[model samples]
Target: MNPALIERLQAVDRQAESMGRGERSAYLKQQAAELGMSLATLYRKLEAVAVKPGRKRRSDAGKSELSLDEAKLISAVLMEAMRRNGKRLMAVRQAVEMLRANGKIEAARIDEETGEVLPLSESTIIRALREYKLHPDQLLQPDPVSRMKSEHPNHCWQIDPSLCVLYYLPRHGKDTGLRVMKEEEFYKNKPKNVVKIEQDRVWRYTGTDHASGTIAVRYYFGGETSANLCDFFIYMMQAKQDTLKDPFRGVPRMVMLDPGSANTSAAFKNLCKSLDVHVQINRPGNPRAKGQVEKANDIVETAFESGLRFTEVNDIDQLNGLAERWMRYYNGTQIHSRHGMTRYQAWNKIKAEQLILPPPADYCRELAVSAPKEAKVSPDLEIRFGGRVYSVKDIKGVLVGQKLLVAKNPWETDGARVATFDADGHETWVAVPQVVFDEMGFRADAAVIGEEYKAPSHTESQQHAKELDKLAMDAETLEQAAAKRKGKAVPFGGELDPYKHQEDTLAARNTLYIERSGQQMDYNRMEVAEQVLSKVEMAKLLKPRIEAAGGDWKQAVALITKQYPDGVAASQLEAVFNQLKTAGRLKLHKTA
Candidate 1:
């Protein structure tokens, strides 16, 4: 009747069915015996259980509804059906989709990774649209939009990088990490964009100005980094400086960049500061945030769409010149769509627009945040502060467990918490002692519990071991003679008398072994218990505290032998020592 009882019967039946003979009846009997019930009782419980179906329905990918408004309208229709029928989640979903398609809504399915909207499955779209209560007209038709004007040339230069088709395509070779990338795992891009040399691959960099419709495309023959981005900024600044007439001598104070590897680097940040350029991090992963640059990228890509091919373009000087020429052609000569004038003429429309310039340079520098806290050094060459990774200079007093200050800025209101390094990286435990453990919890009477054993150290325990062992052996032999003298024969013919067996004198040696070995818990058997004490693990554990004196793991092993005199063997000690050394751990050295 209970789930557990039912499962046991089923297991028995299964085991019976898997056997060679038709032992169904035997399984039923066995299960009944275990449950203390008859076979008929088990059969009654099984009748209430039902078998489930295994077929699965395939999912559609298209969107039936287009806009939010259209989806809502369709949802109203589907919701009405579900309310009338009181349907399930799946049934309601199906009804909504059916009505979405009936309304003839147009919507596209999109891929998250690629950001490409595609024509979707009609049925799937219909289902999704109906759930939203979409309307056909709302999605099928929409109006046009207006555009804004730019004020002057070089006023706003938008920058972004798109891996050309070649950059995304599969290539044959080991990756920079020396790992081989298979075709599927590798990026699929235009083959012409990424040029490969004898061993390395290179990338291209491009920039576009909003006002002049000028596009500057430079080939950056390497992967993205802050350094590469710094170079781009330097080149653009120098070019702007060279082209300036006697009147316009200033740099482009505000430069916009879409979020990319080359854009958000530390080197780029440093370069921007030195050049007095304002740096703004774009809304991450959102391309629409940099709409102007997005459009410029589209135009530049369209121009080179025809002639772009695979060529080992190594000369950056020539590449930059061509990019400048392309910008000139697009900006000075290309006719504007909104205005019949060229880009220069079109920019004049916004030339009268007001400026929102930055404050004085001195103020921005003063308002800047402080950097991360550095590791503190003492005169004795010890790291006084929390030991964490610090800049490798003339470090003094540095210790392994020191914690470092990780502050947002040195000027932040709250001081930073101490951070320490684990195998992963620097981490600080936010919880203070009150959370769980306390140093005071370790002792009851201001006496160090087992840790501070002033009475007798392990070596001293070994010194008294021979005397203790002889007394223990004598007591054990006396107990055995007393047990034999008593009329307690081997219990009902070799049947065990657990209590008297424990009183056996020979077991005294084993009990002493357990006590002296410092292992509080008894293992399943005496031999197994001894074997555990005789293992490499315990020896290896002592290796560290011993080798802290030096790299000789043998010294650590020797300290354990002195303390645990007759305990673990030399072979096991050597084995553990080699294991630590091979694993790059220095064994501890302990003075006996």
Candidate 2:
């Protein structure tokens, strides 16, 4: 019984005691009825001033069919067996098969008399999986989908890229010496197993209208990238079909896509914003938020891509041509399942007046894929923009050493624009780089100084755009350089020399400064002192370098000062350097 309930019963008993004998009997009966117990039971319960406690049941009596550790192991095995993709409840069955095959269940302790192993049934495995609570990605079913409905055709679009299993010949790199591999060999080799895996893969990008269920797709020879997304988006926005009068082509109000690197990239986001389109990211691990396009992707896989496997797809052009033919049929002929009409029919119902087309070429050029960066004009009447030299021929030697803004497109860096801003932050001079393409279509330098022009209002700095550009350039340079040199260079700190020790010390100090955002203030002392390597720390760091140079401390000083090209670290290390010299550990080559 609850303590509160017992207190109420005791209070009623006290009230009964205050009444006469006849009244007490009536009150007891009333209290018994209120307590939902028989009068005799109530009397017995009240008579016992101190109640006897009932014996507690053992928690592990019946529930100990499987130990917690054993259940966890089984659940882990099930998660591994199923991985991230399988039908619902399929993992439970797979878990049983795996456990039985591995003899894990047989290894369990058997009952003494019955000679039966511990429970390892389908239900038990299912219970374990639930109890373990695997991540949504690890489970067959993902998180729930909740997407808003669009009222018009151009209101929203879903864009995503999926790999096509069918193999295709490249425009180049399909050497005559190498024969086309069979489909079996292609599927047998995973991406990690193949050389130049991206080149080996083909991708299909889809843009499905939210309201009308109309889909526009584009094929690419290589795996998906931000460049592929931009080209595909442009294709969908500009494409027209003769089969259907006025095909689905427009700048949608909103475009929903997965949070993949390519979709969420700065360039891609800028492209969408420039076109006045809002971007909505589908929740991570939840693909069903874009169900329409996911269904379209399935259709492309089963209906379209399957047909391409039988034909000779020599290049991306051939594949795109075939895809266009399929799209024509899908848009004009096939009836939409939900609307009970063809996609084209449903799209046309909205009328042409309701749709919005893409902006003109000149306006589109301003919104082209590019990121902003600040560059200072060098003494040569040019700025180092996107790792290449650029200048304005119209105004040579006009803005030397002045700060300028550079808008670089990693996909098309040769045509990057440079602009100089005045005191009011308005662009004074804007020019595009006159890039020279090498024999292999790589940039050498600007052929002629670029011409001046007006900068657009949409110019803004891109997040980590320069880093991305640098990475791309580094990859290309590495690939080219590696072909000639088979051996790698000695990395920093890998050399067995005194210079390495000093280099490591300088690197650590630099990292500390960068991490802490420069000098820190001593609030109690009301003094500001720069965070520099301590004298003891510097001595310890230079000990190896001094020994390596045969006890010559000057070598360590030279190595340390080399790190500070602008003399900042040299000035900071002066105090530590003086202390070392005074201790006679370091020699003063030119003393007073």
Best of the candidates, lDDT: 2
Q: How many backbone clashes does candidate 2 have?
A: 0
Per-candidate alpha-carbon RMSD to the true structure: 33.7, 24.5
**Least accurate stretch of 10 residues (summed lDDT) in model 1?**
428-437
Model 1, position 580, has a per-residue lDDT of: 51
lDDT of each: 0.48, 0.65
Q: Which ranges in model 2 have alpha carbons more than 4 Å from their true place? A: 1-82, 86-144, 172-181, 188-193, 196-201, 239-246, 309-314, 351-354, 361-366, 372-592
For candidate 1, lDDT tens digit of each residue in 1-592? Answer: 6788667656665666567655767766777787787778777754544333586764643433256764565455554554323452334345445654686543456778998876556565565555554533233333343554445655666667654433322234433221222345343463442233312443556665566554556556446665556555555444242342111112354567776766866556544443345566676655555577677667766765333343333344554555566665666677876556766455434432322233233322322223234445322222322232223112222343444433321222222223333466523222111112247643232346577654422233344654454353443454553454364544333544668766776667665434454557966764433244453567556556446645675644555555555556544755655555544334434557
Collision count for each candidate, in order: 50, 0
List, residue by residue over 1-592, the lDDT tens digit for candidate 2. Answer: 6888778877876787789999999988988898899999998888764344698999854453555665666666655655344533445566657776877753245678999666556665555445555432345555555567888878888998987655544445544221345656555556553544457567789889888898788878567788788777777777375625547787788889999999988777766654656788887877678888999998888778776646665556767888887887888788888889888888776657667777553345445566567777554456676677775544422455667666643234265555444577543334556546589765465343376443322212232444444353443454543443344533222345758789989888886434555677666756766655643566566666456534556555664455433433424565544454454445544323
Q: Which stretches of candidate 1 lie over 4 Å from their true place?
A: 1-155, 166-202, 240-250, 274-276, 308-314, 344-592
TM-score of each candidate? Answer: 0.32, 0.43
Candidate 1: Cα lDDT at 523 = 62
Q: After superposition on all CA atoms, how large is the RMSD of candidate 2? A: 24.5
Q: In model 2, where is the ten-residue run with the lowest total lDDT? A: 454-463
